[model samples]
Target: MKSVTRSLRILEAVAQHQPVTVGELTKLFGLPKSTVQRTLVTLNEAGWLRANRKDTTRWEIGARVLAVRPAALQGSSLFAAAREPMIRLRDAVNETIHLSVPDALQCMVVVDRVDCTHAVRTFHAIGDTSPLHATATGRAVLAHLPQADVEELLERGLERFNEDTPTDAEQLRAELRKVRADGYSVNRNQYRPDVCAVAAAILDEAGTPLATVAVSMPDSRYDATRLPELGRLVAETAQEIAGRRDGA
Candidate 1:
């Protein structure tokens, strides 16, 4: 079991920092050189890691990892469950509604959407990852994560995208607490200037965060005065999605 754990850790480290060398891995994990080399060899043979023939000493993640991801994600009911609610939320708010799922340590957008009324508006593309401390959708998902995971993210530190982005861990934690109490999160020009968003988490039967549903609009359309109402709509929509998933 310890060997398996170490092997998985090596795989995770490689995945997180691809095209890494054994020496880098040894330095990063403080592991013995021979152990890292042997683990890499086993993983490479199992097709979980790929090595460059031109530079056999370096390695990157293998294609097998990505091949399994789509299948697993397809098995999830989030897409089917969120499609209608996303459309309705977009129409109700005359804005874009996005569905994002946690991918590794970040949240990635699985759907890009816009209301017919706002067809010209720019929208986040599917597969775009939101900053955890800079966007409402990201914060909503983070608010539901385990405290350990949250602390890990904080220790990694927040990346600043704009003036409103929270770079302080304590402040971000306070905001997450507020989100937990209010059942929704709001971001105003934290990610994109002149844009605003409100988001809430869709929970699974186990009360785990399945995804985040968010409505985004221009600051002109969704100002501070209307944030509470927008937040309520997002929370209700997320709850409905969660309930349907639980029932299913």
Candidate 2:
């Protein structure tokens, strides 16, 4: 029974400070390194936690947790508000639409998705996470965040996923400025190679970003000439979702 309780506490700590290291978790829980490592291994085996893709030494929440409590992760009202608009966006653009919320300034967590009919469309599991500096969905949320918060996130060191990823702080800051000015963000093979996307953030009454809505597709089907239209549609869908969420 004590072991179960300890494991549960460790899981909560991992979710709160995710992409965390075993050494860090041990220090946080005042447990021996061996004990913490054992618990993490147990959780990983149970599908409640997994090592970060970029840095295997760190851990993050797993898809099984999202699969088990989808409604809670979806934030009931936000899910309902985003559903129809996301569907409409996918139908309009014939690309997958994703709704993702910021996980602190660390990453964006995909909470919902409407898939396109294309056999080769881009895909992200509901619990998937991506860096704020490398994804259209992540940048859409990052662009609206406060300057201090953005700076703090930049200080964390952006991990490069592809040659096109903007790892320099100044370069990413400029891109965030563009996202703010254009009311949308575009990513081309930045996070995931050969995937392209356009996205806009859903803002609350205080103008704080609550989540982001993105239209994603494979580069093979992406048309540079359609960017303006795609950006407009994505931005409009984000606004519609925000309005519905507030009204709900």
Candidate 3:
């Protein structure tokens, strides 16, 4: 029990200060170096922590932790900042709004949602995962990521979930470019059949994407003429959330 507690604490510390060293963790916990090293190793073996790619001596939170419990971050500043804006976006667009964070370039995990009053609407449960190349929420974040990282993900193969899913590398790159230019992404039956969505990424102070805010609805209700309006609304909401998150 004591060992489990120590491992959990070390994992949380690694998340807070990623690429941290055993020595730093030891100092923070006041534990023996050997004990701290053992706990880190245990967490690493369990897929909760991983050694930094450039520096093996430092540890960071692993993909499994991000994949399993995105909802656990509901208490985080990002979630707190996004909640009201998401609601307002939903009210304005009359569509379900989602807040999703990237999962190490593997996919986007939904962390929060604000549902619309429509009887027929699209929905993604909290913790739902979506492909980066196929969804508006996913591409909104993907468009802002480093090109090398984006290339690495594309090299893994873009599985076509629907006819609209952009499988060609050059074509997807073009779409990403448009996303960067437009400040938002649009999905028309791309990931899931008959679902349409518009989304924008929330960026950190470094201009790196932190999460995405999306407005989703059934294709029957989608109006091409409303794209500009809906896109603008989602983008502004995302910006507001980012500002609030940074305490600006």
Backbone Cα, N, C clashes tallied per candidate: 0, 0, 0
Worst 10 residues of 1 by lDDT: 103-112
Residue 6 in candidate 1, Cα distance off native in Å: 23
lDDT of 2 by residue, 1-248 (tens): 99999999999999899889999998898999999999999899987888886688999987557555656856688889999999989899889999988766656878889999988889988878788899998899889989988888878889988789999999999999999999999999998988999999999999999989999999898899999999999999999999999999
Where model 3 places Cα greater than 4 Å from the true spot, the runs are: 1-64, 67-71
- For model 3, where is the 10-residue window of minimal lDDT? 63-72
Please give, for residues 1-248, the per-residue lDDT of candidate 3 as tens digits: 98888888888899899989999999999999999998888887876788875588999887568767766787789989999999988888789999988877767888888899999989898767888999998899889999998898788899998778999999999999999999999999998999999999999999999999999999999999998899899999999999999993
Query: Top TM-score: which candidate number?
Result: 3
RMSD of each: 8.9, 5.4, 3.8
Predict model 2's lDDT versus the native: 0.89
What root-mean-square deviation over C-alphas does model 3 reach?
3.8
Deviation in angstroms for 197 in model 2?
A: 0.7
1-248 per-residue lDDT for model 1 (tens digits) = 99999999999999888879999999999999999999999998886787853466788876446434543565567666777778888778788888777653544454545454764554676556567788888888888888988898888889998778999999999999999999999988998888788899898877788788888777777677777788899999998888776666
Please identify which of the two predictions, 1 or 3, would achieve the higher TM-score against the true structure: 3
Global lDDT scores for all candidate models: 0.79, 0.89, 0.89
Model 1 lDDT at residue 130:
68
Candidate 1: residue 12 Cα off by (Å): 14
